[model samples]
Target: MTETVAEAVARRRQYIAGGTMSINRAIGPAKLFVRAKGAYIWDAEGNAYIDYHAGFAPYLFGHGDKDIDDAVIAAIGSGASLIGAGTMPWEAEIAEMLVEAVPGLEQIQLTSTGSEAVSYALRLARAATGRDTVVVMQGGYNGWSDYVSYNLMDPGDVVADHREGDEYPLRVTTAGIPKVIDTTVRVIEYNDLAAAERVLARGDVAALILEPVLQNVGVVKPLPGYLEGLRELCDRYGTVLIFDEVKTGFRHALGGYQAIAGVRPDLCTFGKAVANGYPMGVVGGRREIMALCNDPDPGRRVIIAGTYNGHPVNVAAARASLLRLKARERDVYSELERLGARMQAGIEAIFARRNYPTTFVRQGSAFALYFMDHAPRNWRDIALHNDNERDLAYRRAMIEAGVFHFPAATKQSSISLAHTDDDIDRTLALTEDVVRTLG
Candidate 1:
């Protein structure tokens, strides 16, 4: 007797309930993946699905690239762990590549995850400036840490109703964060220069952290001159401008959004695509700002030290990934843009023909479907989604039709160098069919 798919799913759910760190509201019966190669993944029951999320936008070379795998194997054979050592040779190589690729990155500090990198960057900014207040953009997500989670509006709507003038200034998204942490965080609207200026003029801001391209809520592109204006404001006010390029770094272009947009930030945080699926993060910036980490007086400044700051295996993977990006930069970006445009156009046509109240937002190779009348410019606009049920229904239908994506409804589908014309065509066709069925 063979167990059904439902039974397997139920068993998985039981395992999850037994004890697992529950982050997102993952479905009880998640699809159990057995293997993945190139652009497709196979489930435990040997069903294949075309993966569109690209491992949350990190596997730009696609799943199971032989070059990266070989590099990882070589590094492992040599020795994998050197947690608190002097330096791994590959770490220097990655750092050199990063500084050379990104114009604003004069020096960098490596970390194990995007969250740690971001937290460290914020701490550096505060130490360098001697200011405690951090002004975060309305919808930008830096990490899950307390210092940066004050104002993550679903659609760019800050819950001002819950605020009183200077009375316990911090608002915690989760329970573990102390209420007093709010005093160090100030929330402002993205792309709104007037609102941002009002806050920056307060003289207490140590840094202005934002995702140049918002990837979590939706792929919201920055408005014309918005990033440039912000750069100028930060400079004028002596605030450190930190671009959270974890998602947009290697995806948009070889140098990331800063290169494409032609705006230089004081500091930038990168992860996700840097190691091509390996756990790695980097915080880099002007030499002066980064030097604070090495300040002789430990008691006078912030200290950042991570156990897995630049693991040998991860560094090797990053070096290999960066080499691939450098070698095929033009072809990779062009193909992704072309294929993404085709998919977006096809999806838009489907929505138009069926008269569905849906809009697609795209930037370069990343795209997302928002159940709204128009593309969202900020978090507030995204928060206006009317039908989460329908959104989930469409996502489930797409998955059932053999298209895999991040389970989050707000996720953006990332196009990879390995995705071909046929992959794009199939994805569009399946999406069209799914939209029709939804209608």
Candidate 2:
């Protein structure tokens, strides 16, 4: 007489396309999650799991954080949300906060989701450069808009025997995308400076956009000169460079990856942890480029409009989150670093003691476990070296042992501010169990 998690998932699958709202639910058991609170989740079957997925890397302060939720509720009760007016007053405050905190971003425009931000970034680029082709990374995901739908390496990954300068055939992630997008977008492998230069030499690229760190595939860090090289090539080709930091915007530091890499893009997009689980995104860049969004000349001004672009409640949440970051910059960042280091050390120690051929890669609060001897340089390396089956095995075992991740293996995991030392220790213990069981 009682419905199980599996049963509920099955029933929902009949109506909900793909059985889940996001593509993530299709990876693991399609269970119905009932609720979540501060680094933990409960499924329909009443199983509790320590949540590290954090709703796909948005929960910096963790789920149900009172400071953020209270602000959201207060805004709504005060009639700040769902404002279909021209613009809310608090929009400027949040925008000012972002420009002040993040370096190399002089101005910004708001969007409700990361995908929309990326789309507008491309539009700005095309309008500024008067070019059609936009360059993208082979494995990097910049939202699911038609311009970026090609070459998504999840669920439909190719064998990927791609060589430098070798044209990897484009495969659209979904149907209904115009086939002509293949001509408008050029795909290049991330971290390959030679490939980047070779592609950009054509002098027809409107933009070269990618994640500063190729995060979709297990937090792949850029090689020492890779990011700097990209910046140079973008300048050489007059291509607008846009860094999509939807995942890394607020995790490692308040300034995003550019602060760490010290190489700035022409424009950058922010989402995920910006508002700490609130639906918001931002497209920011140098003053000259970003001003194109509001250029006085009609021919130059790019159209960027959304009804909920700066919802007052979400803006309030962003303000609170950014203020917390600013006030406790040292303590919050230091603690996050400590937690990330602690988790990475524990996991590495396990692999070392167990004599398993595994590698660990981490960036501040974000981390990944690869079933390979060496860290991956890019997606091609991931395809050739990373042991996906073994990686999936460990991830499933950890989930079964009460640790929650993105479900699919390629996603990078994060440790939120809500995660205490005890939480890390328990997670490490569970991780050890999973590793040992896999053996």
Candidate 3:
């Protein structure tokens, strides 16, 4: 008996279920991804979408970049991974490139994902300083690792009527995470120097881990002198400074946030765009701090080990991607900024005309639109956002109008080197249409 095409498709979905696949939402019913190229993707039905999210801001060079593809292909032909404890040539090259691009990165360690990188960096900091406590900024996301996952949000814990000069206590995001972990971690608001100093002065804190520019909460930029002040405070307090550059790395600049901010961190974790969407992460910093990993006294050292930490194929892809980025570094950043500015300006103009309650926050080329009356300074401010319904409507309209952005209302949108002037113009036009539809 011959089966019909519709029946075959249904069988496939049943046999290999897609993630969170359901037909109830505004967008998820269409399981139609067929092909992708630079800045655009075609659905199984052959409909095209102008990709604005860039795989959650990783594909800086965009999808199907020939340079990265060729490198991966060549590496696969040679071998993907080596036998126990062997070095790959591309690993050294990638390390050197990262160190050169990032300031004061005398040593580097590779990992398979951003979470692993942050996890290892925190451990290294604790081991080096012999301190158990870590200070994390409120609303800053440093991956899904257990340590950083605390203090994200809790409706019960929020101070509804927070007042000036009042201490806001840290609240855990999830329940299963031990309350003792909360004791080991201190939470403070970003760009609040006084609050950060108070937390650091506790002396038990080993490190302060944060994204130099908060992308997860929205593209929230650090207040003037905030980063420099953090660097100074950490220095004075003998605490390790860590910059979680997972999202901003490579996208903000070739050297990552440290380069753009001109502030050196004791350690920095990078992922997302490290291999241009390939699953790779890196942690690097001053040699003295990193040397804690190689302490002669084994009992006093930290060890990071992973089977696919520096998988040859990933290293090869990273090396090639880094080289391509270096060659086109100026053009990539300039074009992204130029295009981002144009898009933001266009969106703002549309908002002004419609009198919509919306604002755009940008950091370098990465930006997010907050459908709120004022800019968000922290997660609490973000929680106050009331535009969820309207934002979802706008996102659906954009998707239906041939543009793809992050489904969430508060997440950021990335402008890639692969995006052309035409792509930007088209995106602006579609965005205007979506905003106009909101009225």
What are the RMSD figures for all models against the true structure? 3.0, 1.7, 3.4
lDDT per prediction? 0.81, 0.86, 0.80
Clashing pairs in 3: 32-44
Q: How high is each candidate's TM-score?
A: 0.92, 0.96, 0.90
Per-residue lDDT of candidate 3, residues 323-356 (tens digit) = 8778988987888889888888877887877666
Query: What's model 2's overall lDDT?
Result: 0.86
Q: Top model by lDDT, which number?
A: 2
Overall local distance difference test of candidate 1: 0.81
What TM-score number comes out for model 1? Answer: 0.92
Provide the lDDT at 398 for model 1.
83
For 228-317, candidate 1 gives per-residue lDDT tens digits of: 989998989989999999999988888889999999998899998899899999998989889887788885456778888888888989
Candidate number with the higher TM-score (1 or 3): 1
Ranking of all candidate structures by their lDDT, best first = 2, 1, 3
lDDT by residue (1-439, candidate 2, tens digit) is 9897778878878999988887655766566788999989998778899998888889999999999999989888887656576666787888899999999789999889999999999999999999999988877989889998877763324635577665456777889987777889877788888888988899999999999998889889999998999999999989998899999898888999899899988999998999999999999798888888778999989998998888887888888899999999889889999999999999999999766578899988998888788888888877777777877877888888999877666678989999999999999998888877788
- Clashing pairs for predicted structure model 1, backbone only: 155-379, 155-380, 155-383, 156-379, 156-380, 170-182
Residue 68 lDDT in candidate 3:
92
Model 2: ten consecutive residues of lowest lDDT: 152-161
Which residue pairs in candidate 2 have backbone atoms (N, alpha carbon, C) closer than 3 angstroms, thus clashing?
A: none
| Residue 17, candidate 3: C-alpha displacement in angstroms | 10
